[model samples]
Target: MSVNSESVAKKIKELPHIFVILFCVIVLSAIATYIIPAGQYTRVMDEGIKRMVIDPTSFRYIPNTPVGPFAMFVAIELGLIEAANITFLIFAAFSCLYLMEKTGAVDASIALMVNKTKKNPKFSIGLIVVLMIILAVWGSTGTLSYEEIIAFAPIFVALSIALGYDAITGVAISVVPVGIGFASATVNPFTIGVAQTIAELPVFSGLGYRCAVLVVMTTFTIVYVMRYASMVKKDPSKSLVSGIDYSDFTIDDARMSTPFTFQRKLSMLTLFVGVCVMGYGLIFLKWYINQVAAIFMIVSVIVGIINRWSANRIANTLCEGLSKGVLAALIVGVARGILVVITQGNILDTIIHSCVGVLQHLSLHVSAIGMLVFQNLLNFLIPSGSGQAAVSMPIMTPIADLIHMNRQIAVLIFQFGDGFSNLLWPTSFMVIVCAMVRIPLSRYYRWIIPFYAICFLLQAAFILGAVAINYGPF
Candidate 1:
């Protein structure tokens, strides 16, 4: 009947719902406002890079401005506002995709692919890995896409199910590769490019080593996923969501009977063209949620016309999709809420300053690992790769020099910390993927932990190597 550390800790550990865990974390962050000292750093607009960079030496303590109970609730609203672009894109993207499904285009396509797999089972597994690689490549180039990728998680889940794999396998089929690729940061303008700019290194200069890192991580992911798929195929009882009903993800009887007619082919073509356009925008135009959402709008309209769908039907279907996606959208907003609470507490900078302070006296090699560790912890506070770069890179750049470590290695540490931890953090796009796929966080963690253990080992080895070789174009 009373609150205690043990009971609270147990409750958090046992809590299966991400929503509750997130809110509990928000409450805890709200409490941290009172305990963690408030502080700030002077910021400057660097004309050289045309981006805001911090002056790490300018850190100073500020008066504590702990959030109040009423303000805590308001923070949720503020969080949703700050994250409107993302939440809006979630709705719009789902509507666009659901519109395709309603036109029978997606159904026909899925049914066709399912049939293809039936004829060549080996090719089916190969296709899934190829798809993962394509996506990872997309992420490695700095796309770091959320809406488009997360929206497709269900499709991969359906595909994985068709391939005799579980929903967990399906989610992994998409998420794991993207995480690995982003972590490698071969040519990521957002993470690597920005960090290099801050550190006065040539943009995208360490290409050869980064490419090697990408291949290693991608291979690890592919092997892990393939082995899991093989094990599940041999014994379905071993599936992570073994008892759960996946009928919803299953292709409908009517869809299988509809046949892949010429009109349906046109619809499928539209979907393909739409995806290509998205890829172009992402890679070249550097589109974010709002821009991508606009593409979805345009694509949905064209797709509706292709199928001869009634305008009213399109609207209704879009609404239906939005309704289905509310949970996922709210998860994004709620996850943002946690960050809002932390930011409001003014303790985020204080935490970063304190963490960095401990690393100053360590040896160069150890300081390299410490930078990575700080970044991993910082990922919980700031999940965005570029945003993390902007805030931490300025501080980390000087620390790397101060402790006699290579700045290139410092950037690599940040890249690994931010990208690898993306799949683990509850507040990440991966959480929305888990929610959409109905995989509880606990189960998701159990499934992903081994992959990460291997990931961390490889990352550590790479860090050691980068430090050893001076990993530089500096």
Candidate 2:
């Protein structure tokens, strides 16, 4: 090829990696800090929730907060500190999961299942539904954060391949279900709980509607996944990843028929019981990242003892898992760094205020739609559901009251806005999953945009319905 052609070819062949994308975002956010005015809302303590909330009306310009070049680097450092919990959990949880894999218990279990149902497409569909339900419940309970879900991705991918499907199918059954449940969670404390309390409503009081949303969303996700899986199974050429080689990672009968030994059974049981305990702690004890990390540590030790593996073997497995998780951990910190830049610049609330300004003096229906769109846009900068709630709800709640719109509808709008878009945005968990599965972001974006559109329309209908019924406890 000629020099110009070679340059063009290289440019076409190289897609921007996650690091490149996040770095650009970081730089853009830094520039925004300089351009966007700094402002703050006075925060008052909400005694009921034990957290401070923004006094929406108290906005004032705070001079001299714009990020300088040096401060941008400092923001990245601070972002790592802010993201420490998630990063550590990803490393530790994946370490434990890797330790479990060393025992061959999970693999054996999957293999056994595959051997039993490899011939039956119906059985494969059933497994997909079951896995979706399990993930959905985990998300609904608010225990499964992005890092926690990473540990499950490889297992589901292996299972999907074993059952004659692609890695995308694996992701659909694993991460997608969790996202669906999160978007429509009936009892998720992080999103629903926080938003409701901020709205001055009883916590988890409007469950009848949330439960309905959950069922509908979960069912849609399952059917969508199965249809894709069915197509890929019938014609492997139809797979999105058909051109990509997955030979080394694919599972077959020989791997499956490997004996499910007594030690392996014990190890598997240890993992199962650990998860149950973790779930209980998450709901009843209000466990956070630290508690979940401790649970994984305990389970790793138990699995090692059950397998009679040497300390060195356990240590080596842990190191390997941590190594694999490093990219994801870095991504989380980088994403948080972008938020830090925006926050320190004081532009986050300014952006929120601007969005709210657009909806003011509009009809309640238009304002509700505007709020949903605003939340969706804000999520790109503040990806954390609870974090977004703390910042946005204080403002949104009173706006609802002013317009004579139900606060419950406001919370419901927040729920949908904070969620469904999570999968579409680059700054959210989509990058983590794309990294985990080795799918290029460009392809995943193209494939998922259609699905996002469908979900968004459904969400709009729900918001309008809530408005019509004045859905609320107040």
Candidate 3:
């Protein structure tokens, strides 16, 4: 592409038009409600329908209401809540990241990496890719922050700059790889674990399938990010510039004169041990993950104070970082708002009831595949893997058993539907993360679309083939 074309692409990549896209989706859905005649069982509920306009105050209720012009109001309401929750978490994560930076620990680590990578540039890329896979595997074990952009973002930026790539490439690689890991995770606390547990299946029972998906998705993410980075390296104009230079990220110009002190080393050890313990509590001991985050945050703060850092400075840094984090968080609300509007307008119910009604008519043999397809389609509306699992599993599991469909296959259907769509969904948390890092949705789609398409087909084929081969959970 020419310089002007690359500049245009960069601008398009940074377009913060989620709200506008959502507005259009709401309009299209509303039009569909009328133009696409409702199937026999898909009747809209007038009483549930609430009409309102999109605004800060009303966006939170959008996801729960019925479909129509009024449904837009509901979307706005629900969007607000989703945005708020994500924003809060991001703020908290950024606070932790800032503390890590302030203590000079982050710098020291970077120096070690730079020294190592300076010996071999290709080794650096390989190391980053490997780390991404490791972090992803850790994520699968139901450990580590699924939302790790704050920690990884700066590191990747520094690495990219060090490697002679632009900041955008760093941000893209940092967020995308981990996101694919989360999406493909079989043992993720939020989705797979929760879904399987709810279905009464053994925890981590489908490890083989999940691992296969994870490997495929992770390879896809790494290849795409590396290619994008190469493109930006070849032509800087292709990279989005935030008007910030590499030096702006420097925590301190002076390198650590003293060797790693016992205190600093001790502090690092404590943080590592604490995190591992917290993960143990969360996964094996049945402790809540939020509780783990809270404890870790508290411990990190204590470590900061003990390291002789000024409390006031730490607080200010955290606040500054959090403000940036909140901007990224708001996109979640915009996406969720679309769902709220549709639900409020009763269109979601109309669609679901219609699908179920149709399923009732199909022969049991076909119904199995039909239900799987139906669940995947619903993922478009409900992008949250956990929320979708919660809502769908209860309704689909018994039906699967009743129709003699393998329950394991039914569960896999939910997993595939939830996992794969995450890559493409505009509203998913991972997708918003990509946008926040200025990785154009179109660019992401360009690279991963083929991989995801293949994965989807493979998953569908696997499910159907299982049925054909008389594969049963027993």
Per-model TM values vs. the true structure: 0.95, 0.95, 0.76
Which consecutive 10 residues in model 1 have the weakest lDDT in total?
9-18
The predicted structure with the larger TM-score, 1 or 2, is 2
What is each predicted model's overall lDDT from 0 to 1? 0.83, 0.84, 0.63
Cα lDDT tens digits for candidate 2, 260-305: 9999988888888988888899889988888888889899988987
**What is residue 41's positional error in candidate 3, in angstroms?**
11
Q: What RMSD does each model have against the real structure?
A: 3.9, 2.2, 7.2
Q: Write the per-residue lDDT of candidate 3 for residues 1-474, one digit (tens) a residue.
A: 999999897777654566666667767776666644332222221221121111211112122232556656666767777556455656676667666666666667666666677687677778768877876667556455445444457666766765667665675566556555666666786676666666667766767766776786677667766776777767876765534445755434365232456666666666677667777786787765356557557756776776876878767777776666665666667667777665545566557656766876777667866876787688889886666766666556666776777666677777767666665666666565554455555555665577567666766776776677655433
After TM-score superposition, the amount by which residue 451's alpha carbon in candidate 2 deviates from its true location, in angstroms, is 0.8
Q: Report how far off residue 206 is in candidate 2 (Å).
A: 1.5
**lDDT per residue (tens digit) for residues 199-296 in model 1:** 88999988899899998888888889889889999999998777678898877667666577787788778767777877777778877667878878
Clashing pairs in 1: none
